[model samples]
Target chain A: METDKIHRWHDMGGQPAGEIKREEHDFALWEKRVDALQVLTSGKGYFTVDGLRRVLEDMGEEAFETMSYYERWVQSVNQNLLEAGVYTIAELAERMEQVQARGETYGECAGSGE
Target chain B: MPHDHHDHSHDTDGLSPSGHPYRPDQDHKLTRWQAMEIAMRELLVEKGIVTAAEITETVEQMDRRSPADGAKVVARAWVDPSFKARLLENGTEAIRELGIEPGVLKLIAVENTARTHNVVVCTLCSCYPRNLLGLPPDWYKQRAYRSRVVKTPRKVLAEFGLELPESTQVRVHDSTADMRYLVVPARPEGTEGLDEAALAELVSRDAMIGVATARHP
Candidate 1:
């Protein structure tokens, strides 16, 4: 508390307004990532069929009797992106960095002292 | 496919670039590692990021091509019933007899039966028998394929132009860590009397998926 009182906190009104805008963008980016990841299987995990099913049961999640939930989600993203001329694997990596950058900027402004 | 070095000493009898038909790199069916490497090399050259000479070290880094190893083993298995039984039992060791590495770990060969066809998919990651089958397909790496294969292999296969008869069974091998799979594709009927080399030619990679049977007369 004493150390906090000693240092001057910068005014962040202008930046905080921009922070809200950045948050919206960050959410949009994450939506795309989730959209991308959900439809497809990067097959990069401890991803076993039984294990996934067990988790669903444990969480009491509704069993979507279709092809595993995220698998089709990922494909839909790919198909959509492909139709849009941007369905390649590179989109995931590119979106991730933008998401992180937006998140950090938002956190910085949100923590700024009044 | 261009062979300018040999052609230089020979004929001037060639026409327009018919010998080298323009084709998409992805359509080339080159191994993913090779394709990716070639793409990277071309990109670097185009961007002037690396000189052409600097690419030499990266060029020779390929380990092997596709399942020429598995094909040899399958061909031998066709000729030798004992070997077929052994292959059905232990694929890695059986494949090793043909002097083909079955990859670094234990490999499993699941037979695609007449009643039911099986396909393998590693839902979590791009886990594959790189030493056996070489690099996997780009579509294989897509989360779409990995996610749905176990839960909806038949449906997925249908999309890939595979159809199963109503009487046929469809068991999906959800490949996980410590295990890898290759489909011990059923031998086609018409090619029964063929020699091992001829049989090997018919044992195409897609046959391993139990999708399209090997090309035969």
Candidate 2:
């Protein structure tokens, strides 16, 4: 009877999986920036860590398999920020367009243009 | 463009300034998510919610926290019985004695003895004590580690080269919610004369995660 309960994709305890890949990589600048943004925004009471996790879980299993760690985090953080009314979706879309128009590379787009 | 005037001749064979191999981010084409990150950060700063300096400071603070902090606590517990007792009783408060702020994390320090071994995993997501022991490792966030660690801890531990005896019990702690786990692995033998600082050297990140025992020095 306990097995009949509907299990969510995010609740992945005791699931069958492959061998653990023992590789490790250093955090990229963009990844670290995403992490920093989450910490700063959460600390300022915009959203809790649980709020972020909720959005991440709602993203579905396809996202988990396709997107990288920070990619999902950026999406979750953006969703939480939008839900909190930190900024409008239109404003975010405009900003993202401006960022993409800056250059083809991350270093070119991420600068403050000082 | 801001980068137009900068010199591009300082080559380090694709390594970043921190000596790690550069992730394909800066030189590679901008991704949708990277654009989103830059956009969101800029928007937040423009709206006066968080300053650029504060974001930088937060990243620096997180970077400063490492397994070394957890190692110090384990080392102290190895040397002081009262501290060990206090740590097992109340991990959050006991860690504060060493000046480590766990923030709102409800830490539960699990001890490994001759009869029992403890391991930790976050089945839902990667909920680690980043305040005390830095970010969770790459494997820790992977599906294999999260899914199988709870179901077959012995097989998982064996994958990490830790072969426990049949008599010893393996207790897997699932960090499904707020409470985080820190495994205080049994100290290695023949190190009774070592001081706390020296003892700290033997405690690696894997040991504290319960995937492997503390390194023998």
lDDT of 1 by residue, B4-121 (tens): 5674544333222324222222123332222222332233344444444443322222224466666776778778889888888998788778777664467787776687687776
lDDT of each residue in A25-83, candidate 1, tens digit only: 11111222332232122232213333433343333213232333333333343333333
Scored against the native two-chain complex, candidate 2 gets a DockQ of: 0.65
- The TM-score of candidate 2's chain A against the true chain A comes to 0.92
- Candidate 2 global CA lDDT score: 0.89
lDDT accuracy of residue B158 in candidate 2: 92
TM-score of each: 0.49, 0.92
- State the DockQ of every prediction: 0.02, 0.65
Alpha-carbon lDDT, every model? 0.49, 0.89
Q: Write the per-residue lDDT of candidate 2 for residues B116-151, one digit (tens) a residue.
A: 999999999998878767888889999999999998
